[model samples]
Target: MHKTRIGRDGPNVSVLALGGASLGGVYQDVSQGEADAVVQAALDAGINLIDVAPYYGLTRAETALGAALKGVPRSDFVLMTKVGRYGDKTWNFSREATLRSLDESRARLGVDYIDVLQCHDIEHGDRRQLIEEALPTLRDLKGQGAIGRIGITGYDLSVLEDVATTEQVDTVMAYCTYSLQDRRLAGVAQRLGRSGVAVFNASPLGMGLLTSKGPPDWHPGHPSVWAAAAEAARRCEALGVDLSFVALQFALQTAAANGIVSTVVGMSKPSNLDRNIEALTTPIDPAVLTAVEAALAPVRDKGWDVLPGGGGKAGK
Candidate 1:
C-alpha cells in the first residue's frame, strides 16, 4: 500500500485508511470479534491509518479499536481520533472539556497519545467558538504531547478553509463531495494538498448511495436518484462490473488526480475489507467508467447540498 503525508509535514498515513464508523456499527451491529478481524485484516493488508470518533457508536468503535491494537506495536499504526463532542450529543469545546475528552479517548483506546486529534464535525457547532476554542486547544494538546497532528473534520468546506487559512491544523477531512457523482472539491484539493494540509477525502460510497443495493431508509436522496443509481448499476452489470466497484475506484482515482492525501472507507466485516482491497488493487476498466458515467449522468452531483469548502450537506 502507498502512503501520503498529512498536511505539510505530519506523519505518513496509508493511502487507504480504515474509517471506524462501521466498527462502531453505524449501519449494522458488529460483534467485537468481527470488528477485531476487520482491524486485523487492515493491518495484514498494510493499511496504517485508522480514523475513529466518539460519535461513531458513541465510543463503541474506540473501545473495539483499542482492544484490537492491544498486542500490536504502537509505532506500527497511525491512530486518528477526535474531541469536542460529548457522548450525550452535546457540544463542548471548552479547554476543560477538550482535555477531558482527550483523556477519555486515550483511556478508551488504551493509548498514551493519539497520532492525529481533530475537532470532529466542527460544522455543527458555533463556528466562531470552535475555531477560537477547540482548534487552539488542539494545538495546545499537541504542544503538551497529548496529541501528534492537529486536524479538523467536517461537512462544511468554507468553514474548513476558514480554519485552514487562519488556524494551525495539520490536516482537514472532507467527506462525500469528491466521489464520481460530485467533483466539487476538484479545483481546491490539489492546491491544498500542494500547500501541505493533507486533504483527506472520505465517504466514497456517499453513505451507500452509490452502491448496487442503495442507501438506508434515512438517506435523503430523491427517489429518482436511486433509480438513476440503479440504472448505473445495471450498466456496470452489463459489463460484468459492480457499480460499487466503480464508485470506490472513481473516488480513489479522483482523490489521486486531485492530489488528495488519502481515501477512507469503512467495513464491519472482513469480507467487506477484502473486497475493497481487491477493488484498489484492480485496474478500473475505462469502458465501465464511461458507461457508469453515462448512466449516472442525470444524477451526478444530485444527492447533497454543497458547502463552500467542498464539503456536503445531506439532501433532506
Candidate 2:
C-alpha cells in the first residue's frame, strides 16, 4: 500500500481506502464476523482510510465499523463518513440537522473525533443550504475538535467542482466518474488538487456495472451505458479476465497519475479483500485494457442525469 499526502498539507494516508457500505450489507447480507474480517484485512494490508456514511444501511455500517475497530489504536486508521443524505429521497442540509448527524455518527463509530467528516452526496442536497448552513457548521466542528478535516462527496463532477471551489472543504469524493467507462473526474480532480482539495475516487467498478455479475436492477445507468458495459465485460471475459479487475486497475493507475488522493473500494467479505489487494499489486496487460476501453467507447463519460443541487429529481 502506497501512502501520499491527502492534500497540499494534510496528513499522509493510503492511496487505497476501504469503503464501508458493504460492511452494513448494502450489497449483500454480511454477518458481524464477516464485517470484522473485512476491516481487519484492510488494516493488515496497510489500508489506513475507512469511509462510511449513516445512509449506508441506515447507520448499520457505522455501528459495524465501530465494533470492528474497537480494539485497534485510533491513530492507526483514518475514519471518513458523511452526513445530509439519509435515504433515497431524503436530504437535510440544515445547520440543526448537520449538528445532530455528526453527534449520531460519532456515537455510532465510537470515536471522539473523526479524521474527515464529509457532506455525503452533496449534489442531492440544496446547494445553498450546504454552503450557508452545513459547511459553516462543519468548520465550527473542526475548530472544536469534533473532526480533523471537511469534505464533500457526490457522483456529479460539476457539483463537486462547484462546491469545492466556492466553499471550504479539504477533500472531495467522486464516485463512478473515474472508472474505465467514465473519465470525467480527471479534469475536476486535477483542478481540485491544484487548489489544495484532496480527491477520493470511489466506485472503481461503477456500482457493480464493471463486475462479472453486471449492474444491479436498481442501477440508474442509461440503457446505452448498460449495453456498452456489457460488451466490455464480454470482451474481458473472452480474454479470460474479470472486467472488475481491469476497472480497478484503471482507476488506481489513473488516480495515481492524475494527482487524485485515493481510490476507494468496498468489501463485504474477507475474500473480497484479497481480490482488491491483487488489483493494487498486479500489472494490467495493456492489450486487454485497450480492448476493454474500445468496447466501452460508445458510452464513455456518459453520466446519468441528476438535478442540479439535488432539487425536484432524485438519483441514486
The 10-residue segment with the lowest total lDDT in model 1: 307-316
Task: Give a tens-digit lDDT track for model 1, residues 1-316.
Answer: 8887776667878888999988887779998999889999898888999999987888899998888888899988999998876553467777787888888889989999899898877777667778778878888878899888888887667777677767856788888767877666666577667667778888888777788887776665567776777888888888887888888887776577787888889878889888888778788889999988887788777645421222223211
Model 2, range 207-300, lDDT digits (tens) per residue? Answer: 8889888887767777778888899989999999989999988888768788689988998877888888888888899999999989888888
- Per-candidate clashes come to 5, 0
User: Against the true structure, what is every candidate's RMSD?
Assistant: 3.0, 2.5
Which stretches of candidate 2 lie above 4 Å from their native place? 306-316
The estimated TM-scores of all candidates read 0.92, 0.96
Candidate 1 collision pairs: 7-196, 7-198, 8-196, 157-309, 158-309
Error of 2 at 22 (Å): 0.3
> Which sections of candidate 1 miss by over 4 Å?
87-89, 306-316
Against the true structure, whose lDDT is highest?
2
